[model samples]
Every structure is written in C-alpha cells, then in structure tokens.
Target chain A: MAEHTILVVEDDSTVRELLKYRLGKHYEVYTATNGKEALDQIEETIPDLIISDIMMPKMDGFALQSALQADKNTRVIPFIFLTARADEEARQQGERKGVDDYITKPFDMETLLSRVERLLERIDMFQNQLDAEIGRDFSNRLLPDHTPDIDGYELDFHSESRQQGGGDLFDWTETEKGTYFLTIGDVMGKGLRAKFYAFSFLSYVRGTLHTLLEESTSPAALMGELNDMLLNDDVLEDTFATFLLFHWDPHAHTVTYANAGHCRPVLMTPDGATVHEHSDLILGLEEDITFSEVSLDLDPGTALLSYTDGLTEQHTQEGGMLGEDGVRDLAVDAYDDASSIQALLDGVLSQSASDSFEDDLLVVWLKRLAE
Target chain B: MSFDAETASSETVIIHVGEALDFRNADDFKATFQEHVDEGVRQFILNFSDTEVLDSTGLGSIFSLYRAISPDDGKVAFADVSEPVQVVVQLTRTYKVFRQFPSVEAAREAFAE
Candidate 1:
C-alpha cells in the first residue's frame, strides 16, 4: 500500500499546521498558502486528493475548484472543501461543481480524517473497476488492415466503435481465383462480451469459408451452415447478431449476397440508388432457419454499400431517425459525385445529429471497374 | 430506473418499464419484477411503451424473470413493446418465449384466457 498524498490549501498558518500535523500521520501532506499556490503545487506533483479552505485570499476555494474541474489532468482528483460558512448555497455550489466531500469549520479532526479515508477507498475501488474494463476492451478490440488488392474492383471499409470495444466486425478475404468473401455484422450488445462474440463469429465464418469453398460457394448454403453452427453454441443463447455476407466474382462480374436481419444494402447505379431488401431473420435465433440468396450483375461503375443498423438508426437533431431512406439518399449523392468510398462514409457520419454515437458503425463499399 | 406495477386483475400485474433498460438498470428491473413474483403475482404483463432502448443485459434480466416464474407455471407476456425494444426481443428470439400483445389490456386478457 502506497502512502496516499494529499495537498492542504489554507491561508491561516495555524490551521494549515494543524491539518499537516494530523493528516501527515496517515498520508504525505503538502501545504499551499492559497488557491494560486495550490495550482502551482498541483502542476509540480498531482496529489491523490485535495483539501482546501473555501474562504482564502489570493484566489478563493471556489475559483480553485473551478479551475481544477476545468483541467483534464487534475480534474479527477478527490476534492474536499473546508468551509467556515456552512450555508446551503455554498454547499449547493460545491455539489454543483462536483466536490467529493465537504467539512465545516470547527469540525472534529477525527471526522475529517475518516471522511478522507472513506473517499480515498472509494476512489481506489472506482479506479480498479475502470482499469479492468479498459483492459478487457483493449484486449478484445479488432482492427483489420486495408482490404487485399483485387483485379478490376475497388473496395473500401470503415468501422467505428462507440466504446473501447464495440460489437461491429467486418472482413474481406480472397478465397480462390477471382472470388472474394466480404462480411459485416453487429453483435447484440456492447463491451467485452459483444467483442468476444463478434470475434468468435468472425473466426467461425472464416474457418467455414475455407472448408466449404472447396465444396460449395453458394451464399445461401454458407448462411444456413453458419446459422446451424451458431445455434449449437448454447452460451450465445441470450445474444444475437445481424450479418450480411457477400460473395463477389470479378471474372464473372457478379455478386451473390445473403442477408441475416442486417440493414438492407444499397446499390448505387448510374440511374439511381436502390435498397436490396430481403425477408431474412437475424442469425443465431433458431437452428432450422434458411437464408435466400440474391445475385446481381456487377455493371461498370456500380457501387454496393453494406452496413450495420447503427448507420440507419442514427438520430437527427429533431429526434427523428436518419432511416434507410436517408442512407440511400447519401449513397445516391456520393455516387453522383463519384466520391471515394471513405469520403461517402464520412459524409454519412457528418450528417449525424450528435457527435457521440450510441452504437457501433460499420460501412463497406465496393465499386466495379469499367473494363 | 423506474418501475410502476399495477394490479391488472386478481392474478395479473402489469409492470410499466421506464425509459432506457440496459446494463445499468438490468438488476433493478429484475429485482422489481421478482418482488412482484414473491408477492404471489403469477401473471406478468410487461408494458414497454415507455422504454426507449433495451440491450442484451436488459433481455437477460427479462429472461431471468421468466425462468424464475416458469417452474410455478406463472405466465409472462409483453405489451406495447417499442421499436427499439422489439428489435432486441425479436433478434434474440425472446418474443417466442413470451407472448406479445398490442396493449396491456390485451396482455391481461391473454392471462385470463
């Protein structure tokens, strides 16, 4: 156990000496004459907690707390305000500024010490929980490199997680000659469990693709097999995922796709943009589910975009959804401008009402080349 | 996390879920539902018209409630499931486990039947 460090800010020398003497027995105490001095002390060495008198000269305690709250580096340090005036307004102001604790003047030394101990314990517990979450999230996060080079086709993919670990996963792999497999999916929840499920699903798909490509490359067959495999995993009973799988053949100039309750993929042609809607339920729901396949001829300069529900379900400023139609419109505009897939996806995100996303976002776009 | 439970009939209790049922409020949701079950309320009508979102944990909590009442032959149905909540329920196949109705009145009538 490390000796906790505490900074005591007080203008009166007598009170400062008393605090230092009492707190020093349990913690390493640092002294500051006023708020200004305390700021300088914090810059030098950030203490575990700060104890300051409210009515000090050369920058009052409120100003000091406000400044500390404004600073990202020192904002999270546990703060305790010592106030001579025990008025409701002062307490309310302290509460509004997010002070950790408050001690009225003429208070017992024992009371102050116990409060400090309790606050430090709470801070330690919170820090442990946060560190564990970050560790789990970091360990589970997966970011694949750029798509592999394929002849006569341009592919672009983008994905963002709302948290440290998100539920969205997308991958593109060339299975054989002129044939590629692309998939995008979203697990039911967020955080560590979602990430684990996503990684497991991705690996299962990849493994199955390798084995099944030798037998059959039919999208419908692949989806059906994958559904059976997922249904066998009883641990995933409470969770589910929406997935879109595409099989592209550059030599044949066609793309066969299967949907599993994911958002409809948008097809952008010279004429306009159209959504490829299918009547498929989400994956992992049942063992005997069947997924139908749809094949489309890849015309020169045609773009197909697949994404998770996070994109269409984005909220607008007025609380309305961007919806599938909005995404289609964006795709149509992007196709008209002939923008890069990355630029088009960026445009879609920029139109989001809030800067913070509530769910993971994934977008994959592929355009056939004119030969 | 607010739960409003109303005695719809002699054996049915309609629990109106408040906004946002997710990981943060899952425990409270389960606890509130369990409290009603403990008081001999067998039939449950979960009204989700006010619920804006429900994640996997929220679904897990509902499943837990279902499991708790299953052995006793207690009934659990959903009413007025919002779009967001319906998406989770449908995707997880939870809708198959619990019957769904358009309104609380409909759910209560199902319990009566």
Candidate 2:
C-alpha cells in the first residue's frame, strides 16, 4: 500500500509538532506555518489529505480553498478544517466551503483520529477510482484494436482508437534464420470491423513471414508473395494496407527493410536525419507486385521512427500539418540528447489543444545496437 | 457498384455482383440489399463468379444480408464463387455464412431444396 500524505496548515509550531507526533505513524506528514505556505506546499506536491486552520496571516484557509477551486490543477485535492470556533455560523460556513470534515480546537485525540481516518479512507477510494480511469485510458491508448502486443516487444507500444479500435498494428519476432522480423501496418478503416480486418491482415502477414523465414532470407520476396495473395486471390477489393517489413541480421549488424505505400520513416543518427522514402504502391493494388528492399548497416545509437499518418494529421488551431518536419525536429532533438522516445511523443501530443484523435496513430522507435 | 436482383421465390432473391465491391461501391450493394429485405424477401443467392474483388466493407455487407435472411429461416447461397473471391471469403469468414457452389445452377437447385 502507498503511504498516505497529509499536509497540516497551522501557525502554531506546537500544534503542528503535536499532530506530526500523533499522525506520523499513520501518514507521511507535511507541516506549513500558515495557509500561504500550505498552498505553496500543495503547488509543489498535492497531498492526499489537507488539514488547515481557518485563520492565518497573509492567506487564510477560505482563500486557499477558493484558489484551489479556481485552478483546475489542485481543485480535486480533499480538504478538512481544524478550527477553534464552535459557532453554528462558522460550522455552517465550513460545510458550505466544502471542507470534508471539521474538528474543533481542544478536540479529543480519539475523535480527531477517527475523522482523519475516515477522510483518508475516502481519499483512498477516490484514488482507486482515478486509477481505474487511468487504466481505461491507457488500455484505449495501447490496445485500441485489442491486438496483442508483438511477442517480444509488448512494452514498446501505445494505441489510440477513435471509435472502437484503430487499425494500426505492430509485431516483432526472432526468426530461426538468426534474424528478427519487425512488421507494422495500417489497414484502411476504423472501428471493430476495421479492427477485425487489421487483426486478420496481421495474422496473415505474420504467419506467412514466420513460415517463410525457414525458406527465404529476402524480406522483399516475402512481401511480394504476400502482395500477390492479397491482390489476386483475396476477396477484399478496396481493403488494403500500407506496411513496413524489416529483417535485422544480427551477425552482419545490418537491417533490410521494405515498404508499401507507408509513410517514409525518419532514421536518426549522429550524422543527421535521413528520410527513408522507399516505395509508392500500396499492397493489394495489383496481382503481381514486386517490392524493393533497402539495406543499411546498423549504427550504434541509431534510432528508427515509424508512425501512422494520424500523428502527422494532427493540426494546430491554425490548421498546420504537425508535418514531417515538425516531428523530425523533435526526433532529432530527442535523439541528440538521448531522450526517451515516449517523451518525444508526449511532448508533441501535449502541444495539441484537443485530445480527440482523427485516426489511429501507431509509433515505433527501434534503436540500433550501440558499439 | 451496380447490381441486378431477381426474385426467385416468395422466400428467395438472387443478387448479381458486378464491378468492384469496395468503399465506393458498398452503398450500391447496401441500398439494393436493404430494398430486398424491406420487400420481405429473405432468402438470397449472391452470384460472385464475375465479381473481381470484395473488400472488408463488401464482405460485411454480405454478412449483413445473411443476418437479414437467416432470422426468418431463410437462406443465402453464393453461385460460381471465383477462386480469388473465394480466398477473400475464406479469410473474412463470410463464406461460412452461406452455402457456396461452383455454378449458379447448383445454387439455384439448393434453393429449390
């Protein structure tokens, strides 16, 4: 269980120390000499429960509560009043001010602990609720289509589905050929139906890639055969996907990649940003399609950034394309500073005013082995 | 997107598939199929021997038609499902919704039974 945090706002060091002595065993105690200091304490770290005296110099408890409500950030923190006044009007005012519980001065230690314990329990309940909401949002973020994460790379993913689930998918597997196969694809629709298609498409591609690894070493040939099946025999007409397939040869320190109508990924290295715009035709467009492969020697500290159009399609209030260059700049800055890729994504997403997404965004960051 | 429908019996309808069944053409398929369902025609046989391709949306439309018919103890069959179209059907699981045959005559005969 997490330790409960309590902030006690009182001008008297004696009472503060007393409460700290009394509550220290049950809570992580923070003390403030006045309401101003209490608010400052809260601004830095929101305590699980706040206990404040009604009157203080510079800022008072009522004023602090009002400030908390006015600012969206600290409004939800629970507050309780510890006051000397026993007047009916004062008690009514405390209730109206939304103080969770009130304790009179010279109160019995048992009653005070009971009230504080109840407040902490309520805070714990709310925290669990908040945790559940975060869990739901994270699930929606990482598994929009409910496709299980790639066998070996589950932690390196996040998904956003607009209505049901997005069609973007990624998978990784180490082949018996002493190579690792990484695949990412975006099917051309949304919702459960689109999710089903995305899953079906990935199933076909991943199964075929695994099966073919024993017979072939060329990623381009595998894509060619997969495309042929999709184009010639697949009943899906308008159904198609833009995909990128990669084969990493550990022995040679090289990676071979092929693309089909997907966005050009930015490969960031110490030299600078290299745009890998390999092909134009989408899969399932024709019966006998051939894909070309690009071979590169993996450089240590090299990072490859691949993403769906959803990320690029996000526009500012001014309707500017978040654009390839904008993302490239972020990636370059992050790669140069050796910042985490997730941080780069968070920075870009925070810049947008609205959290609503137009389509699914699938992003992958792969780092080449460092020498 | 163009389709031709023939009423075979009080319980059966035959829809002819032509051109591509894709996002652009799904509306034509939906509009016609909905019209049949609205007309109290439940049983259906879709001739896919000539259809070049059926995308996810098109396959979904086929499933919707089957749902519309199967509830009334009606049936839908596919006639002359070409090899390529059959592959898509198999992948999508839509082929399981109806009895498919090599020729329209077989589909029509199955409907008679």
Candidate 3:
C-alpha cells in the first residue's frame, strides 16, 4: 500500500510540532504556517488530506478552503478545520463552506485522530462507488472495437453519447448464412434511465432477430415484429425508441433497410447524394403499426451513411441547426477529399457549436468496393 | 421547468409549462399536474408555447396525467405547441392520445363539448 500523506497548516509552533509528532508515526506529514504556504506545498505534491487552522496570518483557513474549492484539482481532497472558537456560528460557517470535519482547539487527541480516519474511509467509499458506476456505464454501452470484415465492402462505425452512459446504441453481426445484420437505435431522453432502456432494447433485439430472420427477409416485417414486441413489453409503454435496421446480402449486392422514425440515411454516388426518407411511426407508441422498407442495389464505389438525430440537430454558431443538408454537404466534401472514415466523422463533429453534444450521436458508414 | 396553473373555467384549467421538460423535472411536472386534478378540475389545457423541448420522460409524465384523468372521464388537450414539439408529437403518435388546438381559447371551447 502507498503511504498516505497529510498536510498540517497551523501558525502555533507548539501545536504544529505536536501534530507532526503524533501523526508522523502513521502518515507522512507536511506542515505549512498559513494558507499561502499550504497552497505552495499543495502545488508541490497533493496530499490525501489537509488539516488547517482557522486563524493565521497571510491567509486563514476559510480563505484556504475557498481557494481549494475554486481549483478543480484540489477541491475533492478531504479537508478538516481546526479552530479555537467553539461557537456554533463558526462551526456552521465551516459546514457551509463544505469542510469535511471540524476539530476545536484543546481537543482530545484520540477524537481528532478518529475523525481523520473516518473522513479518509468515507472518501475511499465514495471513490469506489464512482469507479463502479463508470465501469457499469462502459460495459452497458459497449461499442464495436473493430468493424467486421465483409466481402465486397468496407465498413466503419462510430458512436458517442453526450454522457458517460448514453442512449445511442449500434451493433453488427454475421449470421451462419453470412448475412450481416446491422442495427442502430436511440432511446428518447438522457441519463441512466435512457441508458437502461437502450440496453434492454438492444438485448431484446439481439435475442429475437434470429427468429425474425428465419420468418422473413424483408426489413419491414422484422421492424413490425420488433414494434409489437416493444408495445407488448409492459416496461416500455412510457418510453420510445427511434431505430433503424439494415440487412446486406453480399451475394446479390443489395441493401434493404427499415426506419422507425430515425433520421434518413444518405447515399453518396459519383453523381450526387440522395437521402432515403421512408420512415414509419416510432416504436412503443402504438400496436400493429407497419414499417416500410427501402431497397437499393449496391453499386461499386457507392457509400451509404446513417446516423441519429444528434448529428443533424446540433446547433451551429449562428444558433441554427446543422440539419440534414449540412450533414449531406459534409459527407460529400469528405468523400471528394478522399478522407478516411475518422476524418469524415471529425468533419461532422467540427460543425457543432460546442465540444459535447446535447444528445447522443451515432454514425455507420459503408461503401461497396469495385469488383 | 416551471408550471403555472389557473382556472380557465369551473370545469377547465390551463397549465402553462415554461422551458424544457425532461427527466430533470418529470416528477415535479407530474405532481403539479396531479395537484390540479385532485382539485376537481376535469379538463386540462397544456400550454407548450414556451416549452423548448420535451423528452420521452416528459412525454411519459403527460401520459401519466392522461391516465389519471381518463378514469373520471376527464379530458386533456394541448394549446400553442411549438413547431419542434409538434415534430415529436407527430413522430411518437402522441397526438392520438391528446387533442391539440391552435390556442388556449380553441382548447377551452373544445373542452366545453
């Protein structure tokens, strides 16, 4: 285990020496005479905890706490205030400023030590919880690390959620017959609840796709079944998802796709770009709704891109959205520039007004290679 | 989110919602709407003219309010829905669940029937 470091700030030499002597056995101790000295020490090496005195020259404990809180780097470190004034007002002020603990002067040594130990343990517990939440988020929204190699085609896929765990999901898999099934979905909303709904939707689709595949080859039929399943599932009544499913047949060099109120997919050819705009009602809204499918022959060197609303709905500097036209223009420009998939996505993201999106974004790009 | 409720008539109430509605304020929205429902208001006009966005959770809250009032034969309607909100309403087919009108006066007239 690494040694825990503690910084003690006090103006009184006697008290400072006493604390250093007592804490030195268990922890590596550093001392500062005032807030300014303490900040300099913090800059040198951040300690696990800080014990500060309230009344000192140059800078007081309150000033130090404010300075620490203002800085992102030192704000999370546990802080304990030491004071001579035992009045309720002083203690309340410390509490209001988010001090971890307060120890009055002439206090019991054991009491101070125990409080320090408890604060450290609590910080550890909080950190553990945060780490676990991040782990769960990453696993639930896991993206494909590498695109599956398919004959006669080059594929690229990218997705980014506005939050750590987001509502956007995408996946592609090849069945035993070598048919590729690709799906992308966006659950309506943000945060953990949306992520939960997205995960549930993905799991249901993955489990039922094979059976639906055996029953029908039409994308519309598969979408209808999926819609019914979502409506029948009691948990999904209030929530809805916009989804798109695509089936690519390598032998026939054809692509058929169905949209459930998702954004239209853009097809880029040597001539120009066209958006496939056929769509049905979003899922989980009504029962027995039929989705429509659009099929197109995959001509050599033609590329297709599908994405969620996040990309097109992003606000630009002028407070206007980069709508479908902007997305198409960017895609065409990237294609003309002979850019890689990553570069194309970068071009799309650069149009956003901010670094992060208000909604989750996803894109799937596929191009048929020349024979 | 901010909600303002006023009695438009003895049987109808207008609830004006301000700003965006999503998971952040869904529970508050539900509670505020239910309070008026318990006060014996049978008809509700949700004013969304000031509402910029409504996510699924916000829509769910509206659905919950509908479920609450439907048992009593009460009705729910929307007035002055912005263009963006209309797209969501159309895409989710939520328009089927609630009646929409051009303005508060039109919705109040519809409630009289």
Best of the candidates, lDDT: 3
Question: Tens-digit lDDT track for model 1 on A313-370?
Answer: 6886767667788889888877745455556666666777777565677778888866
Give the Cα RMSD of candidate 2.
20.1
Per-residue lDDT of A1-371 in model 2, one digit per residue for the tens?
A: 55789998888778889998998889999999887888788878888888888888888888888888788887777788888887898899888877788888977877888888987887778766765564445334333343223323222445565543346777777787566777877775545545656666776777787778889868789889877766554455445677788787656767798887676788878888877766535665444556789997767767788887677656655655565677787778767444456666766766665655555677877666455
Q: Where does candidate 1 stray beyond 4 Å?
A: A1-141, A234-237, A337-339, A356-358, B5-13, B30-44, B54-78, B81-100
Model 1 agreement with the true structure over B16-50: per-residue lDDT tens digits: 88788776777678778888889888888989998
Clashing pairs in 2: A141-A159, A142-A159, A235-B88, A236-B54, A237-B54, A237-B55
Chain B TM-score of candidate number 1: 0.92
Show the colliding residue pairs in model 1.
Answer: none
Candidate whose DockQ is highest: 3
DockQ each: 0.24, 0.02, 0.29
Q: What is the TM-score of chain B alone in each candidate?
A: 0.92, 0.89, 0.92
lDDT of 2 at A215: 91
Q: What CAPRI-style quality would you assign to candidate 1?
A: acceptable
Cα deviation of A128, candidate 3, in Å: 10
* Deviation (Å) of A235 in candidate 3: 4.3
Question: On lDDT, who's better, 2 or 3?
Answer: 3
lDDT of 2 at A66: 83
